[model samples]
Target: MDLLINHFWELTITGLAIGAVYALVALGYTMVYGVLRLINFAHSEVFMWGSFAAVWALMAVGAGKASGLGLAGYLVIGFVAAMTVSALIAMLLERVAYRPLRKRNSPPLIALISAIGASFALSELMGLRDKPLGWFNLENLRDYLGRPRENLPLPLQIQTKAVFPVFNYDVTNIDLIVLLSAIVMMVILDQFIRRSRLGRGIRAVAMDPEAAALMGINRDRVIRLTFLIGGIMAGAAAMMYLLKIGVTRYNAGFILGVKAFTAAVLGGIGNIRGALLGGFVLGVAENYGSALFGSQWKDVVAFLLLVVILLFRPTGLLGESLGKARA
Candidate 1:
């Protein structure tokens, strides 16, 4: 029983760490959905790009070398670079893919199709570029920007040679960093939406675009800002993801994006707080379910939870009709 309890706590911590990442990614999905009433399927790709960006940046800064300013410094530089690149890419994607569609006043179906196409195109680009990118060598920019050739070692290490503290819990430094960063980001986002002018614009547009425009809010600008914020969040998630699980490939975002999107729905689409809650719940549930039924059924468990939630509490735990209410 003691052994089981120990393992449970460890797994719980691991689950929360992962869940924090999911929550960050889910914020992008929920935010866009709330304001535009559209599911940005391509948001996952934004995350993928962010991860690649960080990997590349780390390599550029000689992160993998045995003698750099150490892992901590490398991580700081890598994260900032990755976030910047991801945000830019996300904004561009919005402009090229969704903005034009919105301008055309296209039907939601058409917009959805556009998102699918953009996702495929982006993924295919990564695939075609993957081979030339090389492995951990970091010679070319692609090598830096691409996924690792091999899987990163387990973030945790156990010390068998220690007499005093025999069982060392060596959680990955990156994981802790990622978890903390996510929390910081959430707080920043909360403040932005609650206290900033841009946030006010976002809320106003979310409530009623026509009214917002009537009040002199640039509807287009607000929409763009929404995409921008979402993109930045996705980028941050990407950095943590690569650090936690090193190998990156095209289409990586597809599965992750889907799960994050599910979380958004589970939390009641368009509710920021709901997204956070749903993400953590899903993460923990998935981890425990995998522990109980094996990894193969983990995804099945997540979907089952979604189904049960929708069937019973469609509005989610905290997602009431308060979407229109200012944060």
Candidate 2:
């Protein structure tokens, strides 16, 4: 019984950490889908870019070797830098790739194709870009964020080791930070959507663009805001992901994005709270499934759950009722 309890606690902590990352990434999907009803497949690349940006920033600050700043300060700086860069890139992508198609009254398929093309382009750019354009190297960004180890003076290290429990695993500092950051961000976003002027515009656009426009809402501006908000969320998620996993690659976002998208759908697409609920649920389910079956079957379990959910609850846990208001 003790052993089982220990295992359960370990899994719960792990699940929560992973779920937080999923929720961060999933928010981008839910927000974009809420307004445009288009899945921004390029969103994964936005996350990738954010990871790379943080890496470059650390290198520039000479913190690549983990030489400077307390842990909190390092994280704050890295997250802010990453968010800014990623948001800018996401905006550019929307303007260059998505907006043009939207303007032309192109079919949703066309927009999807554009998203795919843009995703590939960003990945290729990371592969080819000389001098490592962002703050950190893509290859090492994950490790830097996750472990963040530095060499301390031998005496200080020995003293610190003597004082602190070496293997205590209630929850990692990284895990706590990620969870808290995700909660704060989500709360702020929820309030923004419910209370702010732009928030109303966004809700209005999602509900009915024609009606929103008739009410003097600027559709283009609202659309841009949606992309920007999604991009910012992705950037934050990318930072958390790297911190948790400790490494990244140019194509890392592909699988993460797919899973997050699944989470969005699982919670009921276009529903804000649904995305949050779906991400955590999927994260716990995936971890538990892997523990029971094997890591290889994790994906199968995720899809199976989705299929089962769709079979019975076609509208998802929250249902399509959320979209009815907009409809």
Candidate 3:
């Protein structure tokens, strides 16, 4: 309690920044659930793949000593690389894992099993770096694949320079970049979903697949678009994760993915805006809990908060159905 009070502003700002990442990742989970009523567990790998893409892109450009406009250009390169890779992987996951099952009218349970299988396959593919290299005889790629199962660090180090002070806590450039970037992305997504023609198709399918199909909406295209959009969001979140944490592994997304799912459920599984609210709340609460108890207890605190909230309101904080989202 004392620790939290002493560093309230610091915790809050840091928590929000972390929460922004969670929120972006959570968006993927929420959107998939809204349309297909299935949990795409493999979405985590989409994030992990994006992280690697960013690192590789930065490395390719010799970002190790970049500064000024050059550094900014490299940042853009990383984001584009990550987003593109993540989006492609996401679409592939859908086409390979879920689409076939849907075509067969497979049960939701079967689709779930496929999701789990896809997740493991993707993770192991990254972990077994040598197999692919050996298959292709790509000796030069060994540097990038380094130690099959080890953590990969970013090529460039981001300095944490404080940009301002709030309540005696210095807010850094990273904090503003993370928080503002997340807000802008969220607003863009919300508006796109509410106003675009494709967005209406998504909502129509979420509300009633048969009716949507009858109305000339292509359910297949909507599903693909949903996965694409979710992938893009996950890709952006991957960049945010790299900026904040600076290290990643093949299985890195496992824990964070679970937390993001919790955020999705905490906000209402199928609600877009609910995900944003839930993520911020979870992040701040986790920080406070860490201060009061210990950093090790952070996960416990987050899940406990989720349990408590669900006990009272099973639907979630802003539990509006995606089909009925307000403009």
Question: lDDT winner among the candidates?
Answer: 3
TM-score of each: 0.86, 0.85, 0.97
TM-score, cand. 2: 0.85
lDDT of each: 0.75, 0.75, 0.89
Backbone clash tally (model 3) = 0
Between prediction 1 and prediction 3, which has the larger TM-score? 3
Candidate with the larger TM-score of 2 and 3: 3
Highest-TM-score candidate: 3
Candidate 2 whole-model C-alpha lDDT, 0 to 1:
0.75
Alpha-carbon runs more than 4 Å astray in model 1: 1-6, 65-69, 130-172, 320-322
Candidate 1 lDDT, 70-184, residue by residue in tens? 6567667667876787788778888999889899899999888888888888877766665554565545554333343333222222222211221444455445676788889
Q: Which residue pairs does candidate 1 place in steric collision?
A: 56-144, 56-145
Per-residue CA lDDT of model 3 for 1-327, tens digit only, reads 888988999999999999988999999999999999999999999999998889888888878855567767877887889889999999999999999999999999999999999999999998886778887899888897767788888786666788889988999877877788789889999999999999989989988889999999999999999999999998888888888888888998898899899999899888999998888988888999899899999999999999999988898888747787554
